[model samples]
Target: MKKQLLVAVSLCAGFIASAMADSRVTIHYPGQSQALVLQGAANLEQLTLRPELNGRTWWPGTVIAERTASGIQQQTQQQTQQQLLARLSAFSAALRGDNDGELAGSVDRVRTQLAAMRVTGRQFVPLDPDWIRLHAEANRRLSGEYSVYTLSRPTSVQVVGVTTPAGPQPYQPGRDVAEYLQTHQRLSGAEKNVVWVIQPDGKTEKVPVAYWNHRHVEVAPGSIIYVGFSSWSLPRAYRDVNEQIVSLLTHRIPD
Candidate 1:
């Protein structure tokens, strides 16, 4: 597949410097954990999806037929799956402070692995170079400070007035839904979920999956993102995965 558009958004709380030369990254994939030290100029594809990464498995003709349009055998089907998973994972990681997998390993793993495991409704998404850069910066930011900021000052958001398996829980807006799910693993397996944004002036808006993926849909201080159920699986499975992640920063699953 041809490369898609890449946007470089700087979400740093303060300061921007020249991109670093070399960086070490740890990628946690389903059934895999890859660690690589990379040059800033290195493209993500080098580490993610390549013929070698799959270990000498040539593209199955049928898998190619489904993924490529007509003459785009440049990349294989497995490569595509890996690319999409990486993008989804990075976005989910950004939601609540730095509790990427730790806060919700069980739930996040389900979301990450299931999306990779699905047969139909799969699409290849180009790796977001900016995401890698942002991650590197976040890592560097943490290294300079004596203590990580996540511990000193917590990072969280609120979901107001939502019913759950526990029933009528208070809308305490201090923890990101992703972080909440990490500790409360009981509510992870629900099949369907929806996302709602509570505006500043007592207004509410339902955000579509596409809207959430756009870099423009940033979460502000008082904005409330609440996930509700529409169905077991979303219109597009990737959409379900993406929404689940954004909802982790702003989700509400009912029991």
Candidate 2:
């Protein structure tokens, strides 16, 4: 009887141990030919201590995606994309009857670019190892696959929306937001007083660029300078389109 009891206890313990095992994680470093695969890391804290990650720079905009959440993330992105597309189509239709051909052309250009961009199901999580180590959730087990990308610093910023000469421009240090606008010609419907700056880390800022309300907001590298459509030009239902565009741009996968 004693032997049987001991055997049952051992089996139960083994089952629990197996149930708690951590999932595999893959870490990708910049310029490295090979990726480091790890298992048995209980959480972000344990994963950060691996010798393979030692002495590497951790970019503030580092992206971590869990494979388990990819499907749901993809669905969410698709819904958002579809909504944005619908809104853009409505904007185009409304502008068709209006006298502003330049504005209509600008909207069409943005719609085309958005439709062509690829949507990856990857969802970004903050997951900074330095912060994780000091947090209460450090002991929580990490599940599914993880990709830790240490990307190189970007050297250019993308300028888009309602502007000529839109696209990537060489990033200049200490240049204010208004200076960047000077290089590009804002379309008739573009906002004159402000622009939205979407940073690499998914943070958005409203920056004043017009002379009277001009505030010296510095544009960051890899950021997108979105010159939005003027509020008066957009119908009531589409007034939030620019904000939605900024949100989508924030989630965009790094190139």
Candidate 3:
């Protein structure tokens, strides 16, 4: 009788252990407060966003999974090929609609983004075969099997300063001074030797272009880029103008 009771207790514990092993993964959508908890092999196809956006698609974005005593815990995913194709399609459509010849330069920018994404741990990773595999492996390794992502638009950053044909211009994704100088006609005539990034925090950071590719540089949304001759090299009149332009173009955080 005691042997039978021991056997029953062992079976019950085994069931509880199996149940605990089958954990769920969490995914967060853009502009939403709540998160989705999925169990086992949650692929990109399983992800659905609310109030679908017209021109936006799901791109892998990082988020804080939880806040601990140590610091904020971040969750990320591997990139997929579908996201790349979607972005390329959008850029192609933009090129087709380019009546002003300005968008002709965007092709190279799109290619640059594709190139930068070749490596791992990129900021924006799409859901592809490899990504899904990685996601599964990650879930198996981590507790709670947590994952988070967001939807994003193609072009987030705005460009303004001396290089634009008009006053301000829009920069496509993955574009930097390297690609910008290649396509836009240089109007300043003073030699655009400096590239300045005006961040959302109202701070300026100088970006030096080593090659026309400038593969390592990127800017955030609403940030302004100033491309022009260095202020030190310019005459006082020109320097004042450049500073004023950069100052005015700076992005201000909402009060």
Q: List, residue by residue over 1-255, the lDDT tens digit for candidate 3.
A: 999999999999987766665445555565677967666333333332222311233332232132223322321111233344354455445545755233334333433433332122121223333454556642222224444443553244544433444233465667664565555554332335557776543467777764552445666554555564444434343345345434433312111
Off by over 4 Å in 2: 1-21, 24-40, 48-58, 67-70, 98-100, 119-125, 134-141, 145-150
What is the C-alpha local distance difference test score of each model? 0.32, 0.75, 0.43
TM-score of each: 0.21, 0.78, 0.34
**For model 1, how does the per-residue alpha-carbon lDDT over 183-223 read when each residue is reduced to its tens digit?**
22233323223346643222355544332442223443344
Two-way lDDT contest, 1 vs 3, winner:
3
Please provide, for model 2 over 3-111, each residue's C-alpha lDDT reduced to its tens digit, 9 standing for 90 to 100. 9999999999997776566767777776776988878776766776677654454445555556655556556776888889888987887787776676778788777
Off by over 4 Å in 1: 1-76, 96-103, 111-186, 189-255
- Give candidates' CA RMSD values in order: 22.0, 3.7, 15.7
TM-score-based ranking: 2, 3, 1
> What does candidate 2 score on TM?
0.78
Q: Count the backbone clashes (under 3 Å) in each candidate.
A: 4, 0, 3
Where does candidate 3 stray beyond 4 Å? Answer: 1-10, 22-26, 37-59, 62-129, 132-139, 145-147, 157-177, 180-255
Worst window of 10 by summed lDDT in candidate 1 = 143-152
